[model samples]
Target: MAIRGKTILITGASSGLGRAMALSLSHGDNNLVVTARREGLLRELAAEVEAHGSRCTVAVADAVDPAACQQVIDAGLAAYGRIDVAILNAGGGTPTNMAHTDSAAVLRIMRVNFDTLVNFLCPMIDHMRDVGGTIAWTGSPAGFFGLPRSGPYSAAKAAGRVMLDSARVELAGSPVKLVALYPGFTYTPGLDPNDVPIKALIIQPERAAREMLGAIERGRSHHMFPKRIRVLIALGRLMPEWLRRRFLRVASGG
Candidate 1:
């Protein structure tokens, strides 16, 4: 359970939450395998991590490609020999307006959010089961229920939640752990403050990542950030379907 000396692989490490996690874990006696399509940024991060005395490896692979997924696994294994944790964080959302969703755009989102998620994690899980590792996927409060303009994103993340839970049940007796990081709206710079007025309450990525590491270390079933958002998601789920839809519509300006 100690995080000080384990090896962890983090996708989406070029920016945002993944970057924060890399920084948070840099001082630990750990090996970090960070990946993204942005090779330059990834190497830069690797330099920072290495400077802190942790072994750092960088891979440039598209999250959605089966080949890329293989490359990620190979690279991580090649560098660290064992993976203690896999943070499936490479994902993005399209503009919620369906009219703006051209065929190519929808396919692209599906590829990155769903296909890539599975492609990358499936092989990693197979490897983990042999050695008893933890895998945590990045999910969102939006995945808890359908909200207008967030159709594909919600569906993909909801699938992640369900699939991870099912996988956990299947491996009930194993040391391997499957978890979801269901974060609420983050106060990322330039993101709309109008939508999440209480964004000040949003925990920074390092805080969230630190919590996530704790959950993994203890073998928690699942975890969510911003306790209030988790409460809202639970309430929204228990609400009648019609009421839920209405509330979501009103809240999202649909």
Candidate 2:
């Protein structure tokens, strides 16, 4: 389905890919309900969306909290009567050597990436089941396997990806479409340029948003972008476990 003239909910709209997506869809006469913990940025995004000739509602809330997630959903339903699409995009990751990092740090990464998705996923499935809608998740190619210095982040995204895979199968007979979008190394605020080993693999947020939007419009069950990432992932899958680990260690700067 086309994204135009739809009531869409976008989390993590304060910055990065989420903010870019809001602006892209704004010109299509979409009703956007944007949410994030940063009230100031969200309000700024709302103004920009309105300036682009779209109706936008700013609902500031943290994605990790179930109640807060529900509140955002309620606000969207209240403003637009129905949400035709929801982009679960609230998540961030930090590079850390798991051996030195405390348990709390690892758990925090899991909560931010995994819990945030779950908090929104459950409620959205219920709301969209009857009325029919699209639920797209902002996943990563890193989720394909654990990499050096990003174990927890990989685990969280992997968990989310598996859950969505199951959900897609379970909802096969339903009208609800589950889209898993895996973007490569995107140059966003949350990402440190120095941490990226290969500069060529990195992409801008605008391109990532356009790819994600296209996936949703086309109703693709799984989409991983920047062909180079996909090719790398495919090659990794063919390597033996030990060889893959050695390659990853070198590629990720040991």
Q: Which candidate is the best by lDDT?
A: 2
Please give the lDDT score for candidate 2.
0.93
Q: Which ten residues in a row have the lowest lDDT in candidate 1?
A: 188-197
TM-score winner: 2
Report residue 100 deviation for candidate 1 (angstroms).
5.3
Candidate 2 residue pairs that clash: none
**Deviation from native of the Cα of residue 101 in model 1, angstroms:** 3.1
Tens digit of per-residue lDDT, candidate 2, span 1-254: 25799999998899999999999999989999999999999999999999988999999898888998999999999999999999999998888798799999999999999999999999999999999999999988889899888899999999999999999999999989999999998989989988888888899999999999999999999999999999999999899999999999888767
lDDT of 2 at 23: 93
Pairs with backbone N, CA or C atoms under 3 Å apart (clashes), candidate 1: 96-149
TM agreement with the true structure for every prediction: 0.92, 0.98
TM-score of 2: 0.98
